[model samples]
Target: MLKRRPLAVLLGLALLSGCATLGEGGASRLDLIRQRRSLRCGVSGKIPGFSYLQTDGSYSGLDVDLCKAFAAAFVPETGAVDYRPLTAPERFTALRTGEIDLLSRNTTMNLSRDAAGGNGLSFAPVVFHDGQGLMVTTDSGINRLEDLQGQSICVGSGTTTEQNLNDAFEARGIAYTPIKYQDLNQVVAGYLQGRCQAMTSDRSQLAAARSGFADPRRHRILEEVLSKEPLAPASVGGDQRLADAMRWVVYALITAEELGITQATVQRRYNEAKRRPELTRLRRFFGIDAGLGEKLGLNDDFVVKVIRATGHYGEIYNRNLGPQSQVPIPRGLNRLGRDGGVMVAPPFQ
Candidate 1:
């Protein structure tokens, strides 16, 4: 004979299953971003000019600008954003657990991340192009990476730069000790405090950290760049809509720069472009309706807000990290395609 469950027990089981389903199908990442009222962005806690926290408890850097740009796109009038400073190890998990809407940290995009090597996530566009390098004290008598044999090197954990350092040294049969830290600040502190003889990270990061030092002239960044670091934003996997929207945001920035559209000119020229079909279409590229923003459950003006708030790609880059910034990193390979760099945007139309 079959034993029937009590009515209360049966009801409880039914309710539990329903709750499970509801939780599983609750909302998409896009919906969450909208409902949250502000985009939660993960960034480096302290990387100096790249992604450090400001005195006002806000963030300002190339990576920070990108996050703010996306948030402004989502909410134009408010331009609201929640910047979460995450260490290298915390960034990936935060994105995966939906603790953050995006990872705008100074993270390098590589095959492992792109391939989703069991982490169940991937990168967006290559927002900033960077390469790994080593920095040491000017008086260390070491001018090259090859000179660091049997020396101690400081690097961050859960970062590509550390692995690159190990691989480069091993390939050349050089011996060294890796003093791993969580982010650039600790790596810098370690080197500055003589805990390590050399500090290794992305070249732009090295420059940024050096610029923030008490005595910038005391340290020198080596000339040997080891690896190609396509620094970009990241989002968790299984959300095609969110991923596409984020990807296109980056593309739009590049496109705006390539199309010679600055924030100052976007509005003035947008009205004039209304008379020209090509210009109108180009203006629409920034999610100006036509179903792009709608597809992502965002207002049509989302991208326009991003461009207006942060300017086009070149404007943002130059303003935050280029000649105008304190660090003054040269836009070497970051130039537009016409200038022999890899930056190019697809036709907005």
Candidate 2:
């Protein structure tokens, strides 16, 4: 016959176990963010049209807008983001360790990254469909990947960009020296300082780098694309609530664009949604109906807040990468599917 432990002792042990779970992976990420009052977002603060720190003392770009969209969905500040500037190697570790609530850095969605055996991140929808390409000085006469044979090329380390560069060169029976850097800024410096004959990155990035040069026309990006880069926002794999909320935040951006809602138009749309019971889709989208935001553990006005903060997906893109913007890459594949591009989202219902 064994004596039973005190009820207080048993309760203490259970609470300690719960606390331990919350210490690492047991707590809900959504709950954590709400409690913390700000979204810890990882971003590459070097890419101009994607995510960059501006001279005016604020972060701005397509990725920054995505971060704002996420923050606006939950926090009251509309753009309550504690931005964590991270390099390629540092980004995934930050997410997996719960250091960040989300990663809005222009990261690619790949099998190794999304798999549990790998980085174990859940990717949001593809926001930008890009391709890797090479950039060379106009004087180099390196018009094609074949022209890069036997030349030293610069690339960002710890990224698929490097692997794709190697695979492309090797498959072509070409040999080149790789000068790698941990940061995109360093890669650009190495290229500009003549450390390499050519540099490679996502073609949009190549355009961005060129736009800032002393003479933009002096550098030219090659027509040869190395690999497809479908860039998206990412989160650590375990939390379903966090994952689901992020998925819809991204979809809300796209859906708003498809439905012709912008920052200026969202308020009126919200009023329309509130007054009308007949517009089922619009009402559900703006959270006028019951069940949309509740399912995600967020307020019903979440999408409204998101749109008011960052407008729609198209607005974010155009603000950073449009014709008047710094890097004007044509929206070949970044447009809505109905607009002849491949971006589409699930219905609000």
Q: How many clashes (backbone N, Cα, C below 3 Å) per candidate?
A: 0, 0
> Ten-residue segment with the worst summed lDDT in candidate 1?
18-27
TM-score of candidate 2 relative to the true fold: 0.76
lDDT at position 296, candidate 2: 93
What is candidate 1's local distance difference test score?
0.78
Give the range where candidate 2 is weakest over 10 consecutive residues by summed lDDT: 18-27
In Å, residue 114's CA in model 1 sits off its true spot by 3.6
Clash pairs, model 1 backbone? none
In candidate 2, how many Å is residue 207 off?
Answer: 1.6
TM-score of each: 0.73, 0.76
Candidate 2 lDDT score at position 85: 98
Clashing pairs in 2: none
Summarize candidate 2's per-residue lDDT along 300-320 as a digit string, tens digits. 879999999999999998998
Assess candidate 2 and give its lDDT. 0.87
